[model samples]
Structure formats: structure tokens, C-alpha cells
Target: MFNTPGNSKGDFLEQTKAAREERALEKRRDAAAALIQANVRGWLGRLKFSQTILNDIDEIIPDVLDDTDKLHYKPATEIYHQALKFLFVWKKERDKERFAKLCRYLVASLDSDCPNIVMLVYL
Candidate 1:
């Protein structure tokens, strides 16, 4: 029980049994703590800024893909087209308003002549 040497065999056996029980209880406590953490908001407040980051990524992807699509290589253009298709659907489902805003922003700048219409048509 105490830090001193045990005089009785029964005392030593009891201490070992208690130690094992303590270890098992500690493991249970840790598992419960992790489950509680999974239910909590998070240290960083739900990471709401992640939505903005997603929007930012959405805003730039089309221009990058368009540039790649211009490169004339068959495989590269096909892959770029595939990525564009995926992003378009994802943005629509996740942040449709932001998608519309970005589409307008891109279009508003290029609405002058038929030349720009060609670009819009490609998109």
C-alpha cells in the first residue's frame, strides 16, 4: 500500500491488482474524453473560416483551368475539362451563391464585345 517494502504476500498481491484496475480505468477515462471532444465545437470555433477558404479556392480555379485548357495538348485539356466539370458541380452544391457571384464577377469584366463572348461561351 505504501512505498515501503511489503511484509505480507497478500498485501503485494492486492497492490498489483489495484494497479491493474487503475490502469484500466485511466484508459476508459481517455476514451471518454476523446468522445467528448468529437462532440465539441473545436478550439478554433468551428473553423468557419474554412468556408471562406473554400470560396477563395473556388474563385481562382476556373481561371487556372481555362489557362490550361488553352494549351492544346489533348490529355492536358481533357484533364482540365474533367476538373472543371467536377468543380462546377461541387461549387453549385456547396456554395451556389458564391458560385453565382464569381460567375458574375468574371463576366462583368469581359462583357464588351463578341471577342469576350467567345471566352464566356467556352466557360
Candidate 2:
């Protein structure tokens, strides 16, 4: 029988495990892409707004806000301004008071961390 110095059954098993993990990861990526495509199609068929507006709002909100770990009052304030602009435009077509109430609720939720009285003035 032929044998190599470093080649052992354990090394073969480790290699096999790594390959299996890589295949599993690839499968998960494919599934996620399919799910995203289905969601987009469904939203397009049901919602009135164009894909562009939906994409813009999605991008704008997250881009304006800092990550959870780096969140601070300044970025939060900027996010609030951007959100207000979006909300105002949306409310013109929808319910204004309900939109205002939603804004109030959001401000109240952030009060504990931001504690800036100016936020209430906007409400």
C-alpha cells in the first residue's frame, strides 16, 4: 500500500466538511435571490407606486441613518428631516393626521436617547 506522510483520514474528512459548507452557502444565496425576485414581482403587481420611488425611499432612509452601533443625535436628526420630507409628500396623497401621529410616535420613541426638545416642536 502507498501512503503519504501528512495524508491522514482526519485530513480527508476535514476537506469534505469544508466543501459541504461551501455548497450549503451557495444554495442559501440562490434561495435568497429567488425570494427577492418573487417579492419584487408581488409588490409591483399590488402597489400603486413605481419601483423607482420604492427603491429611492428604501435607499434614502437607510443611507441617511447611521448604523445601530454608531447611532447618535445628529444622524438621527438628519434622518428625521429626510423622513419628514418623504412623509409630507406621501401624506398629501394619503391621510395627513395619521401621518402626523406616526411621526409623533417615532419622535416619542427616540426621546429617551436623544432627549432633544426641538424634536417635539416639529410635531
Candidate 3:
């Protein structure tokens, strides 16, 4: 069966049938492999993009908190609020430390003179 010539017509037919089934199985396997790879790439891309966004947020947090009287402060505050909500909701095991550090930084950076800002972070 393994490379030897078939001894009869029935043997040849059986050999061809097995080959066809093997080919179909290989096709299915290839399709599954492709799908798995695509999903993994998408997950990794999203994880990296999320990290980049967090870094950008870290850079702007001080500005958003310090300039409350500016016209943009209101919108920035709203964005900051949303970010806090996101951070608090993030439940990934890998990011627990990062989230905690961000929370600590936010708490420590608050200005006592601005009760609103203080309350916003606490909330």
C-alpha cells in the first residue's frame, strides 16, 4: 500500500479512495491552522494597541488634571473618567499590576484644592 503497485482494480480503487480522504483531511487541517493563526495575530495586535493607548493616556493625564479651568478640561475630564472606568473594569490577570500602578499614580497626582478632581479619581 505504501508505494507498491496495486495487485488488482479493487486494490487500486481502494488506494485512490484512501488518498482522496487523506487529501481532504489535509485541506481541513490547513484551513483550521490558518484560522487559528489569524485569531492569534488579531489578539496580539489588540493587546499591543491597548498598551500603546494606555501609555498615551499616561502622558496626558497630568495635563487633563491640572488645567480644569480651560475649555478643553471638561472634555478631557470626561475622557479621563472614561479611562478610569476602563481601568477599573479591566480584569486581565497580566495587567493587574499595571492597573494598580496607574491607580496609585492617579491618587497621588490629585490636587487637594480641586475637590471635583479628587472626587473624580476616587469615584
Instruction: Quote the RMSD, in angstroms, for model 1.
Output: 9.6
lDDT of 1 by residue, 1-123 (tens): 554565566788999999999999999999999988876757445355454455454544444233333422223333344335545445446667555644543444353343422234363
RMSD of each: 9.6, 17.4, 6.7
Candidate 3 vs. true structure, TM-score:
0.52
| Residue 64 accuracy (lDDT) in model 2 | 19
Best-to-worst lDDT order: 3, 2, 1
Candidate lDDT (C-alpha), each? 0.52, 0.56, 0.61
Tens digits of per-residue lDDT, candidate 3, 1-123, equal 744554676788999999999999999999999999999999999888777766655554443333434412223365466576556446678666556655554554454445444434443
Q: Candidate 3: which stretches are off by over 4 Å?
A: 1-6, 63-78, 81-123
TM per candidate:
0.41, 0.34, 0.52
lDDT top scorer: 3
**Candidate 1 residue runs with Cα over 4 Å from true position:** 1-8, 31-46, 54-91, 112-123
Clashes of each: 0, 0, 0
Clashing pairs in 2: none
Better of 1 and 3 by TM-score: 3
